[model samples]
Target chain A: MRQHLKKAGIILFWLLVWQLVSLLVHNSVMLVGPVETIKCLCRLVVTADFWLSIWYTFWRIGLGFLCASLLGILLAFAGAKKLILGEFLSPFFAALKSVPVASFVVLLLIWFGSKNLSFFTSLIVVLPILYGSTREGLANNDKKLLEMAQVFRIPFGAKLHYILLPGLSPFWKSAFSLALGMCWKAGVAAEVIGQPLQSIGNRLYQAKIYLETGDLLAWTVVIILLSFGVEKAFARLLRLLPGEEKKEPDSMKEKGDVA
Target chain B: MTIQVDHVSKFFDGQPVLDNFCMELSDGNSYLLTGPSGSGKTTLLRILLGLTRPDSGRVRLLGDYKYSAVHAGVVFQEDRLCEPFSAVENVAMVSKKLSPRIAREALEKLLPADALDKPVRELSGGMRRRVAIVRALCVPSDVLLFDEPFTGLDRENRKKAIDLILAEKGSVPLLITGHSDEDLGFCHPIDIRTGVPLQMG
Candidate 1:
């Protein structure tokens, strides 16, 4: 309860600061307070364009993220198994990490047009992160467990499911969270640059062009809420796996079990 | 089944770990591979389990077409139970013949009843050691390899572990590396450093 109160207080203090700054500026077109942003969000939520825009951006970005994460994991597994593959892919992954997102957005816009720009942009932004993390996770896997499996002759599939999957869960969870946030940010940025039809990015561009600061703030809040919601849902799903749960021994509760 | 290691040798960083070591053991006999700390007992076992190639020797497992790893169940020098899994799950995951109930019964003999359901990471070292032993013993294999299997067990639990191993490993050849006379019980002891057999009477 104390933690909850502290968090609420921090949010309230930030809101008060924003309200005071907006009042001092005395220009609603240039800056909007939290109340005005929330009102704009309430008004926007009832409109059909709002839902369609969200759906468009969500599916395109979500699809790209899913494809990149799966492909990254597969490539990382292959690379970890074969040293030559890892060596060949290292330079490519490094280049992806270092190159600017705007350059990719401009180049992709020229090639693929606006319809699929965000999807490809999201994939380009997320792949290197997931790939690097998956390879690192595989490299850090417990050698002793692997040797035990080999000595016992545990089948390949069982080793993957029982040992490797569980061992990689922590890395996978962290990578997914990081990649999900980056996917949204890059996807929207691409949509804004490309001006795709019925996208949150298109909405943001329209609001900026009209100088509606309240709408821009409201849409930004929506993006943050969507990102937070997806991250929390995905993390909760991961925690549901049997290997991830931290259950106390039932016998320990009954007394005199360990002693 | 027969395990024949014909003149195996291993070297690391210009140091001799196993120099022309040779041994042979067959079905229905237990052998204790006794050696000093750096005498390559683990190297020999690794060679037998097909984990490492003998620098200049051949290891042949006769009587089955399965690979050496498939034929041998091992309690590794370290307790290598999957940290997130319960002890019963660890045993049952590796064992082809033992169901969870049977694995639990086998484990209860060596591990406390409460520790059986807890993940191996939460269990103490001694408990984890018994989980490793139970996993190796319950698994279906033609032979067993135990490398210092009783390292963390107390006197009582060590005797219980040995008894459990004996009860479960029926008619299969056993190769173990240990210095304790009690752990060797009825198995023929061989000093791996000298490559000579020693009688433990």
Candidate 2:
């Protein structure tokens, strides 16, 4: 198709520009071309150590993301149900939102060491995002649905399944999209600082130390690919959930029931 | 089941909505609540449905069982259906006794068969209202409430909806709030403003 060819042409043009820039620099340490970066990636992919590092980093960051999501959901429900709990947690959330990631990274590195440094870092980075979105979602639940449930005497289980889940799904999607990217960035930064034994961050650090700009670019590309891939996969899984396919029409909504 | 609203008083922003309201609702009879807007008709219904608390007096359900145990089905003024769910899912989600087949059959009387599987959000307002009506009727409850349930329905569909309600409802009390006196056959009209029952021809 013309569109595909156009996309290919655009990509090739960018690659050509990068190759020219690298030739003009004439210093491999200063700039790595796309070809060298791809070659470095090809060499890295066949190694056992590379796969081990990928797995280690993947699971640590993934576990942090999972933990943050669960906690965020629980806290959201608790805050929505009890006003006092929401008030009590306001300062904590504010502090979490305002505190610098680098400060936490340094402190966490000293306290917990490098083994779980990335885990805690990712959790901290993602928690407030998911929590805030979840709380907003719960707060914005349709009051009409609540009244209907009350009058119909719909059971708690049915209300949760039919109303709450569908209502909160948009918030979940947005939260997950943002949290995924944040988790990967903060997680890799943590690993770079903490220098975990078998991690992509450690590889990136070593590449920088050895002046292997191609390896550094390849590792950076890998992070971007993994982050985007995970986000897409998670969004797909969310779409597969029951009742998630029903999207609100932008314009033709019934006058009174838009809420 | 008998619903007794005894000297119930409710105030919003220091203004009385339901002042010394009293009423008796008996089973096997449908009550048509006719009142002007802001006459506390909805407030009375909310109190009866246990959604609001009265500042004074109490609403008692005098029967063999406790008032809290009795379930009341409601067709809200707005079709308060789960937007993403199909008509069958919306009906069956609240029903403990009626199967999906029975709910589908009940909905088929008021809606086209092809519209049954579509999400309630995609359906027109009339169709959604019918879905709400079917949802209320199909559920296992001791009483039924309809708050302007016929707002967007055509005359023919309104009649069909009424027939569906009558067909599905048993001896349980059905209380409906309507602005017009037309099409209120066999229903005891009660004026919430005067606290007096109006005689109907």
TM-score for the A-chain in each candidate structure: 0.93, 0.90
What interface RMSD does each of the candidate structures achieve?
Answer: 1.3, 1.3
When candidate 2 is compared with the true two-chain complex, its DockQ is 0.69
Prediction 2: B-chain TM-score = 0.93
- Looking at candidate 1 chain B, the ten consecutive residues that score lowest on lDDT are B192-201
In model 2, which residue pairs have backbone atoms overlapping below 3 Å? none
lDDT tens per residue, model 2, B61-99? 878756574588888767878888899999998866768
* DockQ leader: 2
Any runs in candidate 1 off by more than 4 Å, and if so which? A247-259, B63-70, B95-98, B197-201
DockQ for all models: 0.64, 0.69
